[model samples]
Target chain A: MDIATQTETAPPPPPPATTEQQRASRGATRPGDRIFLGLSRGSGIVLLVIMAAIAAFLTYRAALALSDNTGNFLTTFEWDANAIPPKFGIAVLAFGTVVSSIIALVIAVPVAVGIALFISHYAPRKLAVPIAYVIDLLAAVPSIVYGLWGALVVAPNLTGFYSWLDTVLGWTGIFEYQGGAPRSLMTVGILLAIMILPIITNVSREVFLQAPKMHEEAALALGATRWEVIRMSVLPFGRSGIISASMLGLGRALGETIAVATVLSPTFLISASLLDPGGGTFAQNIASKFNEASEYGRDALIASGLVLFLITLLVNGAARMIIARRKEYSGANA
Target chain B: MSTTAPTAQAVTPDTLHAARLPRWTSPLVAIGSAAAAVGIGLAAGLHSRVQWGLIAAVLFVIASYVLATAVEGRRQAKDRFATSMIWVTFLLAVIPLASLIWETVERGSKVFSPYFLSHSMGVVADQDPGGGINHAIIGTLQQVALASLIAVPIGLLTAIYLVEYGRGKLAKAVTFFVDVMTGIPSIVAGLFVLSFWILILGFDFSGWAGAMALSILMMPVVVRSTEEMLKLVPNELREASLALGVPKWRTILKVVLPTAIGGITTGVMLAVARIAGETAPVLLLVWVNPFINTNPFDGAQGSLPLYIYQQYAAGSEASYDRAWAAALALIGFIMILNLVARGIARWKAPKTGR
Candidate 1:
């Protein structure tokens, strides 16, 4: 009777005892635990510091370049940063970068969304897996290889198409091709469209695959056809995913260096016709000019690189924002 | 669009009302449209296959819609149009991918002899070109290996913190910046390293400098992928190990890591493949040397991508052949890595490998 009374009196002793034991065992200040935690935490901190360092170094160098620039940095198309009384600007680079990437976006997004739908919905089970795998491997092809092929094979083959466009759509001005080898902004855009295809397809395909089976079946049972089912069920569900995927591809097209460097027969002026071989991208400009550039010239390239950096950051940031905002976006559980 | 089946056959049963075009309808229409496209392409004197493909795509979509509308109804017409468009898009993508691989193999094969792999570019001129990638191969292997050595530990540790112990503002900042870092252009990474290592500190051109830039490009990929892999290790394992009186670190080291090792390794390999073909950064930091360079710390080194770019820029038949061959080598390396990574993932699970 005494022992039972004692046990009842010491009610819930194990809870407090366990808490104390856990505190003692998992020690707040044990050297090993503290050190391990600190080291791992320190690694994360180091990554942040490295990012900060990149921004700082680039900003400082860019500022130095701007200080030496004789012409308006944003307006002038001239790139004589190495010349005496140097005058240079990023106008041409920015223009080409935006124009080419926009072209890539226009060309790639719709096609990518279509291909994603085909892989996710239209393809037979066996065909879909193998096709997706092949596309993934294509995505792994290096930019330099693309550059070589673009310069040699694709460039020559594109001549017929360029001439055809010129003859058919000459009134548009943008399609007016001079009888030169097809090293133009249009060609770069097409190449980038091809290059970014796999990424957009992969992302959009994943999103489409995640569409709710219940929703699809519901649409079908409502007497909707296959395309109607996709329109009513899958399209709305994967909209944000497709947008972000397109944006990621845009980022890649903007920053692409070697391929553009190899394919474009660059001139300093921004050509009104994309079929003409003129204008320069930020990355391509930096790379093509780096070897012969003086210190100030490199700094100028760094300034343009800074602009490209900021642009990509904004694009990727917007993508992340859309992805985050669409927390209720995916319809897999609906 | 009218419900033609229901209205036209009011006396018929609902079974007739819910009819769709037969499965064979699509295949037959596709073949018919393709034949028409070929006839039209030949008649119009269109030499490019791309034009023929476009015509076929257009014809197929039109035929699908027309046939489906005639047999089924308007809703089925729209459905067939979408399916046809999607299939056309798939074919469009396949054109470039198939051509790129075929052209590379067809052109690159002629030059990819064992002698080409083992020889150096020292004695051969760009115009006179009989040379190999022996030097570039060594440099690429060393630089990429060194980068992995430095990046794996730091990236792995950072991922562990994020998955296991991350809680407050600092962790949030790290996550945001890591995302930002992943999108940082390769050129910017090269520029940053150039300023920090060679310009500010007066270091000379070397493979180590290139490695530094490559590591920056590589680190975020490693962290993101490893974080995913580590997160996949269930908390039950951690709790179970801790309940047995194992230290937190030991529990993570023994149990969590072993579970996630395959995925982490795959991530690392993917990162390797990404950085291996990087040319812009290598162009800036490591000046290419034609001779065999065993030492990456002290002098210029040849790299495969740089070799491709340099050779292509030379604009000679011999140089182009060499460039194609090097490109083939680079593509081969990357594809093999990706395939192996896929194999490892499949080894763990038949699905969800990505």
Candidate 2:
């Protein structure tokens, strides 16, 4: 056929030299290329402008609140938004955010890693796909739904567990329950863990699945068992991914609002015992009190929001750095 | 050498057979012996009934594992056990999702009649609480639609600029800020809108304020999704359009937009869904009202999320039913949107490869 002849002749054509010929045919500064380059260059510039504008605005407003504050912005515990000469600090909020997020990361990371391992290494193809789909669905479940579920279902169920923890781990201040029926930092942590589990699992599963098959096979061929093969081949490859997933989960937990606000009984005091139920996270306190706050009160809350924004930025920045370093380890040319 | 090979092979057969024998047998036997020992020691450390249950469960598991290994060998038994654990995990995930949906539907079924859909809370009192969520439903649609109108264009355009034209300092700065925006708590968006529009712009309790709050939360999602989808619009396609003498902007609008429309629409719908169920922002921006407020620029409006929040917070039995009903409505709406997006994506996905 003519098609077969053309295909046979195609490779014989001097296609490589045609590009050089075209370059000679067309001079530089063609309008088409110029426009293309301009548009591409322009987009990046626009993105920077938008970011600068936002930062400028936030900084302008934040400065208004920080200019006259008496206490150290980072360490003072009291958040007296209603004071005549309003004094506010983020120590308690910062503590709550960090503690809750740390708890969430600790509780979720292992289970998420386990689930990811199960999906990537253990489950059959058909079953793994469906389970992964289900986790995606969990990730898409609205935060407000989680909040409602936490308030209605999870909080009520915590009473017996809290009592059991008090009985068993009473000597450990962290688990000592102070007889509060429904509201505790432990409850918030559990809720946050559940909320963030899907994200970590989804990310970590992808990373685990991407581990080189040859590495796994080599381990197995060396007489190692399946679990040992996974331990050696997959876990090491996905360590950075696990760390990134945890940081992503931590970012989410640090800023989660509705669920924590609905579930936590925040009373503006930090306690070593998670069961003592008396701390307010930056996001939760803002959500709980922002509507009723006066002008100065709103400013105080804005100050807290600034802290949260910074924390999330720091967490995500750290994650990005870890991922960048991991690319180097994996020799990803990208 | 042949004679030596035969002797070596003969010696290896015993060890090879032992290796091929059920690896799980030893563990099962060890667990069985441990359980028996625990049973004998149960009286000293624990209550009789709990200890007996624990002992019985452990003994039953060990017995099953032993029987399986005996009948089917170690590999099959181990595979079966691992498979069952996978099923257990899947079931654990499914149970909560199924229960949540089942409970919502079951509780909300009482108020899911056509009359409920058509009628507003105009006829219902706070105490009576027997009417529908027409006001909240309408407010949800209008305000969310308005927010989409505001957010989608700006977000999509920003994404376009970032993908097509952005570079240098401006692009880097925008990327950073958008990242920051992505992490902004919903409440902060609410507060931002509240302070900016209400205090500074001198507006009070308008659905516009709610739209603003929702838009702030929605923009980052829209931008991220759009950016991703636009990135997927292949460079070859743009080059092809350019080769045909299409202007850059025209190529983006006509060729690139059409090419990526499926994903863009899905992303936009997802962003809508993300903001639609938001309560904290809506609560801070819009005033609660049972009556329908059709105008976003005007007075107080009630949304489904706000309705659920208020009704649930009220804690009255009747109001609780309404709260559940509204929750159901919201979930149903989101589900329908997701299904529609999926359907559209399937229908419009470009055909490739014979």
Candidate 3:
């Protein structure tokens, strides 16, 4: 009732036009102001120019590679981008990258949410803060370190699990293991899932912490149990936030180079079986092949990099849009 | 006899409170579930402890739910189940992180020494592996410091523009592109530098090339964080300064910047932490040289991440030890940066910001 009365009596903000008029009247008009503004504005334009240069350069290199190619750039599976004819394509890379990232997302999101919920809702007050801090530290661990851990420890340990999955789901064909080492997409996905867990957990934890206490208390006061209160109050409020956090994680997974490169054995073929030894992602392919590749081959790799760039850009943009829209709605409602 | 009957009738029962389980009951329930899970795992002969752990987690959830349903109600049962699931997930996440840190420290301490920290790999063979990260340290510091020097001012100015003077389409475009830039893969940045600088201009592989790519990655992170910090500087201070007839630039330099400097430093430190561990761009742009090369513009250079990769790729006992040690060193450096940055953030937090 107090909240209701406060809302009822509080005045709304002034309209944009009047605020602009007021600010314009109050603005400082002087040479120093003008010079300072000009410098800062130039810096902003410089950043825009850098972005334009990156896109233009990448596209120009990609076009150079595509123009000389006799093979289809999008569909062919070969990657002999340095041969006399220089045939190459992104079909296998695209499939493996998307599949591996989706696998990582599927495995990470639920576990991350559970950990976030535990930290925010279930943990004792003293334990939650340290746990959150530890998770932050985990997020800052270098990707190369994760790559080393994944290649040496995690991959070997997963051999038994891979065999088990193969026996259990072998008829599905995708999980079939040939008793080789576990340097496959499945391993990379699992490693990536681990690498990104801290990020998703941290973001979701913050959102869960911000769940409005009034609504939660109202639910509890209605004789609802803890789970019932959460279902009625918390999850609904944090759904969009969770989506945005997961998107951020997905962007990271798609662009991850070292971990995937270090974990998987790359070849130029598309295998339906992710447990097999041969798959390549765009970033991994570029990093691994760049040292040995000819000029033509480098351009082809750049072409694939352009695709990865576009994908991550779209994902991060969507996440930002969702967060911004929610901000506006919450602001208006407040 | 009549008095006794009246006294017995006077002692009426107090039945308002509902019956409940004792506090000890929940712990008792957990112990029972654990015992049951161990028995089942043993009976089934599960080879891996992971399988046993998973079984225990599942059984705990089910047992808690069933017990709660019987003793309390359906809703409470669900709540208990969720709590158990969350605990299990938290443990699952902690297991790997602890293992990674523990493994790195355990192996790394075996070879780490002051001598190891001071000597370069100039005289060490790949298999002999008695080398230190001295060269890598020099390379990492010079590259990261150079990258920071290049990125910070530009990022700070851009943030100022966005926070103070931003109005229309141009600012919005800048904001959007910065977001886009944030997601650019380090490998792509490496490739771009490789093309524009090396392939096109015919420059040799060098630390400066790596610095350029790293600065590209560093700028966006710096911009976003600095923007948030600048926004937190209250407008009232600016108004007061302007009201005193101080020039706008002077006011911003004296008042606004000083107010936000602590947070800006934290942001820059965080950005540094991120770029310091970047391996992909360094791998592509600065072709790793095992020996020390001091010049940034002249020749290939060594870096910590590239050192770790090279040592691990060598596949020998001594090489592995060196890799682990260098990795430990890198993690320590990064962790220090993070702790200091967080400390600054906590220490200098604006009174009203929280």
Candidate 4:
């Protein structure tokens, strides 16, 4: 309670004000303080500048591409940037990026939470430690390796599964699969789900471990079952943490390049069926197309990249906000 | 004994012990479910083993819950059901991850060799039997090292600012934007550098361009990790140092940094590992060249991840083998970095309880 209120009313921490307060209270300032302060503050300023520069430069280049476009930048489907009147749009890329990320999130979040809960609550101490460690290592595995694995092993192995889905859910149109290699958004999404599971699990595991012990004990004292104790105490406490973790995973999925590029067969058109082969995400589009693009074509890809940047930015910002707000309510400054 | 017996009798025997499933029931149910699922799969002509597993999993939950509910009651059954689901989820995640590791090792070992490590794909065609990642390894080392050089100090200083002197709007904004920067897609970072350093500055594709993009990704990771490490330093240590008339900067440099150096190194190493695997930025900026180019500032270079991508894109049996081999090497490098970083973290964890 005291911690919560202290943070609530805390004054902003300006250095000079802090120094003056300190001197008035007990200590004296020293000589090299000014230069050191400038250097450190300069570093912080540089970081902000980098952020601003990224946004500014991307915007400038995106505008250059958008101005020469013969089609609506947001709606048109074609990507013929090198033509006399350049015509391109991000509609398909936007649809593919969002859909694939949503698919990843849907498949990943619940399983990630379960794993997190398993590590934090269910597993024995000896097993939990190693499992957690393994998850961390998995999280550190490179995206390209995942891409290679997805392309070579997962895609081929998934053909039967895709056919099953087509038979089971073909009426929905979303699961309709034409006879081909199973290089589709569904495959990309599933691969992304695997790629990001470790990250979400690791983060939510930390949060679940941090859930206050007293509440769980209290629930147990009320004759709650193990699952009941978790539902009453742990899940509520970790909900925000889980949300933020999922958001982080979502950010990654949206921006993932090589994995999608490796797995998904690239086409400009937006496909209604995730199991069918023709869709393109922003990052994958840029990676696959950038090599063959002209200078103007490159700028057009940059414009799509800017959209991806904005999306991930918004996702990460929301996650940070959730974490920050949780601090105020929980009195636990993460 | 007689008095205790009477008291125990006063409490109804049925109330004393609620019905419960036998201890061995879960495994029995799991086996039953698996047999049932396999039988059903065979009869239905289902080809995918994954479908069988899914069917088995669903049967296990249903059979366990039904058996439990019939005997122990609904509440206990619900608990058992949740336990089974959690286990299923964990196994589901683990299977693919283990498969990835297994596949990489099994397939990768077919072509992996010291010779494969030492040679380059410069002259070898995609279908050829002879080639290696020597040039890519060189390019990866140079790019990552250069990225580290650029990122570490700035990230370190920014972290110090946020931890030590930060208090007002500037600090808050920096903190917020640092979080935002953390999520910038690598390809966007590549695009940023493409626009600023290459496109606007008129520089050709080089390892330097890739490094610039990589450092952008690396910086935020470094700052976030270092900030956490710096925050872990006890305030009393700082107070004691300041009370002795040591300057603020000196105290920070001499005391706090020494205390946190292990963690900082681990953070930086982890950041390096992350960027080393990054293919998008390098794919955009470096423009993979199969031959070795030791000079980062000069021209196109090959990186381990980009090499894997290029080989995999080539679409041949030989190229696939090479790709897998390079992937194994890349994973090996990253795993080593991660292991070392975690080792340092464990080793340098504050020695308390003395």
| lDDT of each residue in A144-220, candidate 2, tens digit only | 66666777766776676677788999898888886855677778888898878888998788788778888889988
Evaluated with lDDT, which candidate comes out highest?
Answer: 4
Q: Please provide, for model 3 over A1-334, each residue's C-alpha lDDT reduced to its tens digit, 9 standing for 90 to 100.
A: 1222343345457555654554443334456777888989998999988887778888888889999998898999988998989998899899889988999999999999998998898889999988988888888888889988888888888888889898999899999999877889999999889888987898788778878888889998987777787788988988998998899889899999988888889988998888988889999998888778998898888889888888888898898777667766655423
Query: Once superposed on the true structure, which residue ranges of model 2 sit more than 4 Å away at CA?
Result: A1-54, A66-77, A83-87, A324-334, B1-92, B119-128, B165-180, B350-354
Instruction: List, residue by residue over B1-354, the lDDT tens digit for candidate 4.
Output: 778988887785667578988889888988999999999999999877888999999999999999989998888888888898899888988888789899999999999999999999999998887899999999999999999999999999999999998989999999999988888889999999999888889999999999999999999999999999999888878878877767778988998999998899999999999999999999999998989999999999999999999999999999999999999999999999999998999899754324
| Clashing residue pairs found in predicted model 1 | none
Poorly placed runs, candidate 1 (over 4 Å)? A1-23, A328-334, B1-19, B349-354
TM-score of 4: 0.93
Q: DockQ, in order, for the candidates?
A: 0.66, 0.25, 0.59, 0.69
True contacts kept of each: 0.75, 0.19, 0.70, 0.81
The pairs that clash in candidate 4 are A13-B167
- Regions more than 4 Å wrong, model 4: A1-31, A332-334, B1-12, B38-47, B352-354
TM-score of 3: 0.92
For model 1, the DockQ equals 0.66
Listed per candidate, the RMSD to the true structure in angstroms reads 5.1, 7.1, 5.7, 4.6
Q: What is the TM-score of each candidate against the true structure?
A: 0.93, 0.81, 0.92, 0.93
Worst 10 residues of 3 chain B by lDDT: B12-21
Superior by lDDT: candidate 2 or candidate 3: 3
Docking quality of model 4: it rates as: medium
Per residue, candidate 1 scores C-alpha lDDT tens digits across B41-128 of 9999987777787888788888777877887788778877777678778878888878888989989987999999999898889887
lDDT of 3 by residue, B1-354 (tens): 778977776696445644456778768877777788789889998788888777767777787788788876776778778777788788888998999999889988889999888888888997995889899998999899989988998999899889877889999999988877887888888888887888778899999999999999999999999999988998888878867767767878898888988899999999999999999999889998878888888799999998998888788899889988999999999999999998999888765534
